[model samples]
Target: MKTYDAIVIGAGPGGYPCAIRLAQLKQKVLCIEKENVGGVCLNWGCIPSKALISAAHLYEKSQAGAAMGIKVSGVELDANKMQDWKEGIVKKLTGGVGSLLKGNGADVVNGTATVVGPKRVDVTRADGSVEQFEATKAIVIATGSTTIEIPTFKFDGDTIIGAKEAVSLRRIPKRLMVIGGGVIGLELGMVYQAFGAELIVVEALPELLTGVDPDCTKIVERKILKRGGTIHKNAKALGYEKQKDGSVGVKILADGKEQTIVVDTVLVAVGMRPSSKGLGLEKVGVTVDQRGFVPTDKFCRTNVPSIYAIGDVSGPPLLAHKATKEGEIAAEVIAGHKAEKDWVAIPGAIFTDPEIATVGLTEAEAKAKGLEVSIGKFPFSVLGKAMAMNETEGFVKIVADKKTKQVLGVHIVGPEASTMISEASLSLEMAAFLEDLSLTIHPHPTLGESLMEAAAHAMGAAIHIANR
Candidate 1:
């Protein structure tokens, strides 16, 4: 048996960073992973999906270069080559993670680890060998989550699949039906749509991208419609049938009616469930909620002092960046440093056609809290940069306190919205007021200037747009 100061189970965005940080803090750490080191985010979810989205975006853009006076011809998508390129990116990232762990002096073991006790873990290696390791100080559970499969639409890895399969499609489907309209579903669905697949999104919720700013979501919805994609909200995917022609017939309940839609593929992207079970956490007295989330305090500490949880296994807003931050906090706290999960907000970015990014509260959320608010919106259609790029499909919206003038939230749906949201996140973090943002000199004719203009519009002092 080997003993270490800390043991991190699952070498994902949450676990690897915790181990690396612990090692950096002069503590001995072991990071054990059942599969690859980089976990789903790096290996399958975030990296691969983004690569495909980028390629699709470029492919779609290449077709319109004639209008820009740049003659372009023979624009095409080579699926196998695209898949190979995406896999190469995944390899580079996962390899970099392994090297970083070794360079940082953190030990990594390839195996499935289960907590045998509060401070002990049993790891089953790939070769059917077992090893025991003890954590002298703490054991961090960063097991992450798995894709949720509907009972009736279980993944067959072919006809019906999850986000993992959707990102790896080698051929564009003639017709694609996505069961969920959340981030994973829409992002991947739109990728195929860009590649010439007819898309049908059936979301059980009342709206697509639920909890996102409805106004921002509206732009994406409009784009999907313009692309000849179908959307059904307030709908449920009851089940699916295997067609004789190697296709899928999905039955969806929407608008108080049942309809069967036939498609070449069905992407089940309802959501993810925490991989908290089967880890022997219950025997060690670790508390996992009914929804499979391991509850943690501000410091990422669980009920058991020596046991901690982070990432998707920990709680909501299961973003890769959120998991990475939590990992750092847990490591610092375990190393006797003062750190906690303290942040104004966790920003979200959806890589739809025009993209949607947001930070802090939405208008409805603020209204629900009974706060008097002022909203300002600036359309990208009127922006010099957006017009120049020929991508003027969305806008920037700023929500602020009516009296205090404190900026509450920033929602954007336009070109580079994902890249533009970091500034808004920083503004919220610094508690910047509407005046602070409005008066700040943003670079002229940039997408970022829209943010400054939106702030000024909230105060009825905008120059580029009519003040409300």
Candidate 2:
């Protein structure tokens, strides 16, 4: 039996970082992966999806360039080329992950791992060889999640699919129907929509983006509606049928009525389920929750002290960055350093048109906690930079405590909202008051100035906009 100080399963955004960090801490680390390095987030999910979104965004922008006095013509999308480019990126990043693990002195093994004991793991390699390794210090489970598939609308890897197939489609659907209106569904749906696909969104919930700030969601929702797209909220996608014309006919229930919509493709992006089962966790006395998540303490330790879990397998927000942070914390803890999963907030970024990014408590959440709050908002419609880019569509909103003027949350919906949110995250982490953001001198004519302006508006001292 081979022995190592620590063993990490699943070389994902969570596992790879944990392995690298553990090796850096001078621990004998062995990282095992059943699939390509970087896991779903790199190979199938975040990176690939973002590449498609960027291509779609550029395509849409080029079509609208006439309005910006650029008179450009022949803006055509080569789906094959875009897909090849996206694959190149995934290949480079996944290769980098493997190189990083080797560079950090962590042993990388390709196989499926099953924990036979609290400290023993049995790995089955490609040649049907089973190798048992003992982790003298800790065994970290970092297997991420898989896309949840609706029973009625099974993935055909063609017309009916999940996010994995959605991102790799070389043929743009003439008409696309998205089954869920959550982050994944909307983001990818908007991508195809930008590529001239008539979009139909079926959301079971009353609103799109249920947990996101409604005001921010409203802007993206409005854009979809304005672009000849249909939204069916409080709706469910029951099933789908393959039509004679090689299209898909989807059955949906909304407002107590059942209707069938025919389209070229159906994307069921309902959500993801944690990959926790079949890992022999139960045999080792490690508890797996009802939702298939591995429950971990602040130190990323499970009920069994020798076993730890992190990332999507551990639970939601199911974010890559959150998983990476937890991986580092777990590595530190296992390395004899005192570290815990402690943070003011985990920021969320949505890549829908006019992108939405948020950090900390929302206004309703604060008020629901019975705390009085103040709200400040600044629209991009009036911002010079937004006008210059011809992408003026959303706003920046600040939620603060009425008494203390301490910023509780920051929400942005506009151009580059994803990039602008890091500052808000920092403010929340530092417990910055409204003045901390408002008093800062932001450069003239930048999208980020909206944050400073929103903070100023919260104090009723805004310069560019009327204080509300």
Candidate models: Cα lDDT each? 0.94, 0.95
On lDDT, the candidate that comes out on top is 2
User: How much is 49 displaced in model 1, in angstroms?
Assistant: 0.3
Per-residue lDDT tens digits for candidate 2, residues 241-283, read 7889999888899999999999999999999999988899998
The TM-score of predicted model 2 comes to 0.99
Residue 71 lDDT in candidate 1 = 82
Q: Kindly report the root-mean-square deviation of model 1 from the true structure over all alpha carbons.
A: 0.9
Clashing residue pairs in candidate 2, if any? none
**TM-score of each prediction:** 0.99, 0.99
